[model samples]
Target: MTETLAETTPHSDEPIPAYPMPRASGCPFDPPPAAQALHDELPVAKVRMWDGSTPWLVTRYGDGRALLADPRVSSQSTLPGFPHPNAGFRENAERRRSFIAMDDPEHARIRRMVTAPFAIKRVEALRPSIQKITDELIDGMLAGPNSADLVSALALPLPSLVICTLLGVPYEDHEFFQEKSSLMINRYSSAEDMIGASDALTDYLDELIGVKLAEPADDMLSELATRVGSGELTRREAASMGVLLLIAGHETTANMIALGTVALLENPDQLAVLRETDDPKVVAKAVEELLRYLTIVHNGRGRVALEDIEVGDATIRAGDGIIIYTGTGNRDPELFPEPDRLDIGRDARRHMAFGFGVHQCLGQPLARVELQVVYGTLYRRIPTLRLATGAGQLPYKHDGLVYGVYELPVTWDA
Candidate 1:
């Protein structure tokens, strides 16, 4: 085999401590006992990946955040000898149809197209619509007999509707997109299942782009299609951008809606404060804290070193893959005093959940707005909303990169 990166072959004195890595199985919401084992044993350790590759897993908050911001560690997966986890799958080619799979210049140019649309100003303009969606969902929830699966009644659909409307994707096909997106992240799905979902999502987006080209609408997708047709963006670039917006625009927010609702249900006192507090700033800060507490990306970030670099105590040389375990970092006791506790009041603005630097989530503002609207309105509307089932019985998606609940059954006195 061609030599791996120099970093992979460190000297004996520079020991690469062995740590337990998260497997594709196990509960996602509650931290895997294995991750805590690794965190306690070696804050920074060499983990043997499922794919039989060795990569440094950074566990400390400071180390993970610093590495995320470091330009030397490239997020691009197309590098030489770079082992993409999905490489052998027939569907990997189609799955790479998003901007997340590209490097700079290409990533930068494409990301810029939707930046303005997702900007705080643009997102703020959608508040009225978001509020309507939230209220409508809540209204429907109220009309239900007594109990409701918040995930289905409100959390899931709110963001899906908002994202679909924003992207000009047909709302009728929302379930189709959701299923494909779920399969893309689902842990239990086979390799063929994953590849198929990836391909299907790409083809669906391609068709959407084609429709957007012939008849533009007052939506982000239409705007992007105009740019692409005008020659500002290549067809491939346009497809990637659309896929990013469509998938991310809903999936992350959908989880936040479900997970955030669970957080409020579990902590009624905090939920009370959020309901009564009129301060958007405070609500925004609380959202950040909740994100940190629920480090959805339990598997850590997937990246490869572009050049020789030093992260924390160790030196990482070119080509060595790195997975910065955000879940571990977010809970590092050093960064977060009493890190495991859910303190919405805690100042967690520095958390790397949305990641750091260039590749930071582009839809953060829209997400924030969607979250604020959902949480701010839901509790106040049903001050007594409580989980209908025992917390243990709640369905959680364990296999995917994002560890989130499936259905959050909640009820309020009618």
Candidate 2:
């Protein structure tokens, strides 16, 4: 039987630690040291959120993997104590619920409508196009000054352009799209400000959905329009999905590209592993290693338990909020021996970077292809590429919902 919060929650005189704990400085690639200690000692423990509500934090690899896949754990944003990643997420969640925040039947039903565009065959067909633009971006980057901020020059534009092409979002509107996404992702943004930004984006996307409905095209939006036309999804739900895709498809992938570049530059031996490899398998493995090493979606995955559940030694009772800290799970020495080291050659296929089970990243195939293309080509093409500024001085995204370097100032030989 499920227990009440007071009956189940272990409380003491000591204050509960904060979620998204501080990472050790100069080691931005690794999981937070405090979280790692929790993995070793109390893998299942309580932590405080922004609203002062305590949630069960699962840090061990085994426990997190199991709990995330459990049917009793609900992703529905409507759950009373669902652990929101940040104040902004908590703020706008109810007004802007996407299919990703829904439970099984609803999530599966809605997610499948958009799956065709991301099917391996469909995504693979874009490889030639991806490569062409990647080369064009690199050409543009090299033709300009030797020193450039890779984030603006290539990292940000590449994914935006690609996803725009795939989803039929006008490339011209990318700046506006990026701006709204920024407001939503800023953890410190007030509920009023974030909700306004979200509603505006929803309105914008709903208008575009209308356009797709009027003049159907061979893109994902048109596909969504067909569903809307069939009454399979309400207009707002379809638009919400569009907003999710537009932000998720670009932002996280952009971060990985820029952050991965910085990581490889810092560890040249690993950089050389990519630089020297001609095999696609080697490049793919390296991408996984990078994903494992720097799980940049550092915010813990949030859910609420529907029934009493055992995680580690603790019983996460019914209605208890849960935050599965994937970064800490990736660093669990039990699953990954000497987990701190970044080894491109090691088999990181089982990594939880894209997460595990039913809610694993929908855009992962496209992301993998993009990363493989960049990691395989970038360093090898420009063998001398190095940081224009010291790694220590580079601005990292400490407060943003996604963890990454804000600007990657890079330089290479003529």
Candidate 3:
């Protein structure tokens, strides 16, 4: 017999701590103190969410990986017991049918259509182009005032240009799409705001798809348009895929670039590790370590248990919600020794920063290549790169889905 929620509770007397506990003021890169404490005390325990529903919070590295890969755990947000990150997400869950929220067969089918462009080999082939883009952006930054917001100067534009080129979307309209995408991912956004952003993006993508169909281009959007024309996918489905790629392709990477830079700046020693290394293998490992240290998707991975599952001394009942605190998992002592330290030399490939299981991030190869180019080239070209302001004063995106700085003020000696 499947255990119920009540039966799974370890401590009936203790009040469940609220989910998404805040990070301490000065510790921007660290996971929330409360979350780390919870993981240390109880790797898997129930935590109350915004809607007054208490869901199982998995914080251990091993348990998080186990639950995420388990078919019994579903990513379908529309499911009755799915733990949404916030109110806006709950409201728009059913209406927005992105493949990230889907299960196999359907998810596989849709993902296959767009996977070719992001395959490791394909992304590797774009290294020279990525390097060129990185160089040009750094050149523009160097040409301008000595002090510039890295967020605008290089972090945001590099990925934006790359994705725009891949999708055949105009880079000139970045301001509009970036605004809508930001609103869509904002944890504090209202239901109406979220839906409006989705509608606007969907409409924009629909128009773009129409253009692609009439005048096919050598891009992912054109490929999606072809599928739509062949009746392999409905127009809405194609648009949904486009919107997913367009938003995810840039937003997550943009945030990673900024956040990783902040992390490197704060730890000049770690930055030196990258600056001194000329080996591609070393640079790639450092990127993985950075990805582990600063898991941009700080908000836990949301899911619903479809069946009774025993995970790390707790029984997750059928229909019970589960939130995998990946940031905490990345810091789990069992997984990485000196979990809090930012060590570029550590074997950090096992980190769940890009998630795991079938829903693992599709654009990871592209993201890795982009970061490899940026981190490798930026410091080499400008050896004196340093933050223009103190790390404590930097503005962080605590209210958004991805964790990053709002502005990374940086400078390098001429």
Candidate 4:
């Protein structure tokens, strides 16, 4: 069952195939025969990258998990002397230190501070507010004319509101800060634009942090500030986490809400099943399936070989960089049977969509709750939800690392 890259094929002079076009590029979600071919014949092969350099893409489920859990591998984007895709985007790599980009003792200490607050129990306590927010968004969707952009009307706003509530951000100022955050995440934007947005977001967070220090509320930001004041966390650490919560809380979920609706609309039978069920457990299962089906964050986790290590017959020498393609690993046939299908109860709990090991997504609990509320409410509230564009004409992200639709148009009877 377990196979290594050397067992299949070794490095070759023949040119590696161009990166496979994502299903988000208007094809079906099934992994192309070409991709699966690579998975089988060369579980780990160097592929031509967008930047004209080659990066090893790990496709087999076991190899991906092994690499993800390996201590020699790191999440740091700025590992000195290693080839990185982000080399152009970052200047003085030491300047940026995202928690996701940190390793070991530092990552452990900072993560411990926020773990309890993001735990399922703490997130469940916000159910009433989340439900109320969902209802309000549904009301707005109904109030609009029959045809509306579901993304702008609901998907985008719902996550923003929920994150604001969690962080105690004033709802009134969300629009301004959310725009700044969006600009930072949209990779298509120029390097200058990204840097500007990052500065603007940091400035905005500093302002909010100042306010929280003065009038501490029962919010995460307030709690972070309290920790900082008590010398538990540095001001820089507190600021970084605040920005991370805001960005991660919204960007990924916004895509899920937008793209998941597209998937359900494509399969009306599944939509019917979900619409008829009001049970939280059922909705939760459906959310997992949708996450698997959408596979929005196509980009993989980045790692480097600190020393020579043998992986599946291939010895990656010290300083070689690798990327564990999580999206590919989640859909490996050996892991999920009929990997392309969207079966809500397919028992896909093993999926790495939220990733695995110590670096698993910290905000996963909140994301799950948001999806359940949004999807459960959408179908029940709008029994006639359908795509406004023709099936073949729906717009989707073609080349982004995180694949999602540019717009999700939908119509429903009021």
Candidate 2 residue-wise lDDT, 272-295, digit = tens: 989998999999999998999999
Q: Which of the two candidates, 3 or 4, achieves a greater TM-score against the reference?
A: 3
lDDT of 4 by residue, 83-124 (tens): 344433454246556677778877888888878878898899
TM-score of each: 0.90, 0.96, 0.96, 0.91
The parts of candidate 2 lying over 4 Å away from their true place are 1-13
Q: List the residue pairs that clash in candidate 3.
A: none
- Weakest ten-residue segment in model 2 by summed lDDT: 1-10
Scanning candidate 3 in windows of ten residues, the lowest lDDT window is 1-10
lDDT (Cα, tens digit) per residue for candidate 3, span 1-414:
455765755666678899778899999999999898888888888898878998988988889998889999998989998988777788778776888888888889988999999888899999999899999999999998788999999999999999999999999999999999999998888888988999899999999999999999999999999999999988888888899999999999899888898898888998898888889988899899999999889878999999999886788899999999899899877778998999988999999999989999999999999999998988888889898899999999998788999899898887
Sequence-dependent TM-score of model 1:
0.90
Which candidate, 3 or 4, has the higher lDDT? Answer: 3
Clash count per candidate: 0, 0, 0, 0
List candidate 3 segments past 4 Å from native: 1-9
Model 1, 1-414: lDDT tens per residue?
A: 335554354443454433334433433344666667666765666766545677777777777777877878787766643434443322463446456766788778777878888888889999999999899988898887878888888887988899889888888998898998888776556788777777677778777888989988998878888988899977666766676678788888888888878877777778878988888887888888888888776657777888877765577778887877777678877778998788888899878888876888888889889988887788888888888887767777665657678888777898
**True lDDT of residue 302, candidate 1:** 74
Candidate 2 RMSD computed on C-alpha atoms after optimal superposition onto the true structure:
3.1
Candidate 3 similarity to native, TM-score: 0.96
lDDT measured at residue 311 in model 2 versus the true structure, 0 to 100? 74
Q: lDDT for model 4, on a 0 to 1 scale?
A: 0.76
Overall local distance difference test of candidate 1: 0.76
Best by lDDT: 3
